[model samples]
Target chain A: MGIAREHDLHKRRFSRNRGVGLALAAFVAIIFGLTVVKVSNMDVVGSYAAGSLTAGGDK
Target chain B: MSDTSARTTPPPAIGGEGDFADYFALLKPRVMSLVVFTALVGLLVAPVPAHPMIALAAILFIAIGGGAAGALNMWWDADIDAMMQRTKARPIPAGRVAPGEALAIGVALSGMSVVMLGLAANWVAAGLLAFTIFFYAVVYTMWLKRRTPQNIVIGGAAGAFPPMIGWAVATGGVSPESLLMFLIVFVWTPPHFWALALFVRSDYEHAGVPMLTVTHGRRATRAHILAYTLLLAPVTIGAGLTSVGGPVYLMVAVALNLWLIWGALNIRRRSEETATADGYRAEKAFFRFSIFYLFLHFGALLAEAALRPYGLGGW
Candidate 1:
């Protein structure tokens, strides 16, 4: 018996798969961008911690 | 239960063919746009400056959280959505996406967005995003929506939280300006929705949603719209004195509030007979103008922020 190359289900699902794939790719990109941005701004975290500590001291 | 019978039976197609757009539709993209715009304004007008990438990621996560809440709302309200003309074409109601799928997507995105926001920004911002999602999905959708005519009045807080969260992303806490932004949207919601409810009068009634127009009558809803608009004028104009406010915002606020009050007064004075005869022309015009009113107010805030560097933006 000959094997079929593709099923109707596969054809119908193409757009959905593409969309999911694109979304995943975008997610990875956003994560990578955020990591770079956060790493570059080490002082931001430090200042935030310092600010919180000062506020607590005042309280 | 035989193999032969199973093979012959067609696969159930209830949610079998949902395209990517169908899934996106579950996210309520229109509402997402409002969240994004307001949140971005909040971020931009903050006293503290954020790096571009950080701001972008913060907005993306906030938008995702908002959309996730919308998906959960669709899942919960699928039944009533099917009964209403405005919502009957939504993903679940139209049978393009399964309710279970929407719920799963909502829950998954909610968790992911919150955690990612925490990592990208401060935990305070992330916490606000999480609370916003919970408020919209659980407090508003599950609790208040069907129970009272004041549903949107109280539930509007969920939509109002975005700019505050955006501000938190920058300043790591709330401030007078952020709260002012929140108040503007919160107060604006009732009149905006009431105007639409006035036009789409029967959708809520048919779906058993106790919208003010349905429960209190059109005349009362009109009055409520006028009252809310009058109340909104002070809150909006008063924001001009806050850190986010500037001469530009004040001018815009004064002009827009006048136009809004005029529109609301028109809506208040018209009887249901005149409205029905004119096909709710005044109500629809007011609804359209309300969108501009909110947009321009926020836009003016952005203008003030933008002009600050050049000494032309704000007071």
Candidate 2:
């Protein structure tokens, strides 16, 4: 009975740690994804601004 | 039984004394890349032209300011980072660099970037750089992040300021065009960030951070992502209609926004089990596409600038 109880406790602890590991992986992925999106969008914003400004100047 | 034991055991520690790469990591290279690219766009799109040397100086200063913000953010978030697995390997948390050292580097770079920009460009650009550093370090990292679910919503403003700073470097003041650029980024940030938040709620929960997922639940977070993307679509299209963007940008915005909206809508429609079964694969795919979306958009602006002399580009 004592050995069985010890094994159960170890299993619970293992599961808890696994949860943490998965959570960490998700967080890293999110940050990376966010960074890439922002960096990539820079040109769209810039060109749009330039086109409008030039058009306004001509008018 | 063998698999169970392997799963139950902790991975071996990869921690050790750091090297140059660790210091570079402390600067947050990915964030710096965004800052550099946006600032370059701001410089290029501005109505006033700058000498090449001055333009180079402005970009370098903006980059240094971005690095300063990263160092300080790492210093302040060291505790939470140590707790969170994703950040556990970071320079300060991983024991590669001391917190005090990071603090000093942050402070030194902040002053250097601001002063150099003021000299090479103008005081306005310098002032904006100083504000960007303070906003990221104090407002975003220290206060907003832990305090609210809207953390990224507001903290994202700091990231959006770089292009405006670049515009100021060229034009010596803020203009309507620069403000529009800032607005587009500001609106885009929430949807961009919340997509990731949907899948990473557990990490924020473990760190005791009140991200949208932790505060509002995954369903509400998904709804918010859709709402923000809807808002982002018009702003992106409007920006393409502006002076900085031309026909090329308009076409790109239309296509990317359509795809982005599709991704957001799919996330909204999917069941939690279905989303989770693939680890929110649709949302993850959207997040991946989001990165390319922004890169292509910005790269198009550079292309527009190159074509301007040939009468092939104009607002």
Candidate 3:
């Protein structure tokens, strides 16, 4: 019985840790995804950035 | 699960190889949050509107650059950080991250942030980002921090640059409004930091950092706080006359600035003995309130920007 109880406690701890890790990952991913999606809607034709690129297009 | 527990119980970390969280802490997420928020306000409040995507990219680059600067600071300040109680738990000081590793990450991220931002936005914004990082890492951290009591006053420029960069992102240049935003933070920084120094002077003294309180004594520090407050009030109110400000910002600026000035005066009157007896209550309160003051002032600008679409903002 003691062994079984300890196992259950260990499982609970693992689950709790996994929950925290997953929550962190989800928060980061959501923010990243939203930013990319919002910017994707705008049409980007070419580089209007400062300097010129090289032979083909950009440097 | 029991087997997993046994496996996880390894010996204590030596040489601080560092975990993911340690790396994240090195980025100084708290400071980055402030940079991101203020930059967002600057972007939104500018006269020119950016495509949502462009805005997002610019902010990400700005945030990454800010975080890079923070990592560099941690690497450089690790010695002093280890010496002080307040900073002893930081990743480097606490032995969770190695100095070389922090330096490498800082340099790499700085280059990436600057270059990528140049591609994502105009060169103007990217240039500001580059300068901000260089100013923070080299000028503020390496040169000024240990040398002068005026560190916070002059180094405040690094923190004050983000809004201008954000403004540049949208407008591709600066305006009177953006300069006003920069000036407000510039003037506000010394008072804000000095108030905290009044309470934490011992920490800086122990760490060998020449904070105003440590160098000038509390009397001079407190007097400076009041003087800065007097200068700050006019600038804060003057912001209301700029394009970025409206009724919301004006009202917030006046109310908050008055409270801060009063807090400074209160602090100026108290002796250190009385302050210690009171546990630095008034100073601590002023410090806390100053944080709220900046947040509310910037928040008011954001609110004004949001209201502009509804004809509720601007002169």
For model 2, what is the alpha-carbon lDDT of residue A10? 65
Docking class of 3: incorrect
Task: Judging by TM-score, tell me the better candidate of 1 and 2.
Answer: 1
Best by TM-score: 1
Which one wins by lDDT: 2 or 3? 3
What tens digits encode model 3's per-residue C-alpha lDDT throughout B203-298?
A: 999999999888788899999999999999999899987888999999999999889989999998999899999999999999999889888989
Encode model 1's per-residue lDDT on B1-315: one tens digit a residue. 569888999755487478888898888899999999999999999999988898999999999999999999999999999999998988887877888999999999999999999988899999999999999999999999999899999999999999999999999999989999999999999999999999998898999999998789988999999999999999999999988998999999999999999999999999999999999999999999999999999999999999999989777
Segments of candidate 3 deviating more than 4 angstroms: A1-59, B1-16
Q: TM-score (chain B) for model 1?
A: 0.96
Which whole-number lDDT from 0 to 100 does residue A17 have in model 1? Answer: 96
The digit string of per-residue lDDT tens for model 1 on A1-59 reads 33566665566589799999999999999989888877767778888989999999999
What lDDT tens digits, residue by residue, belong to model 2 across residues B239-276?
Answer: 77777788888888899999999999998898889998
Compute the DockQ of candidate 2.
Answer: 0.02
Query: Could you tell me how far off, in angstroms, the CA of residue A2 lies in candidate 1 after the best superposition?
Result: 13
Which residue ranges in model 2 land beyond 4 Å of their true spot? A1-59, B1-17
For candidate 1, what is the TM-score? 0.91
Better of 1 and 3 by DockQ: 1
| lDDT at position B303, candidate 3 | 92
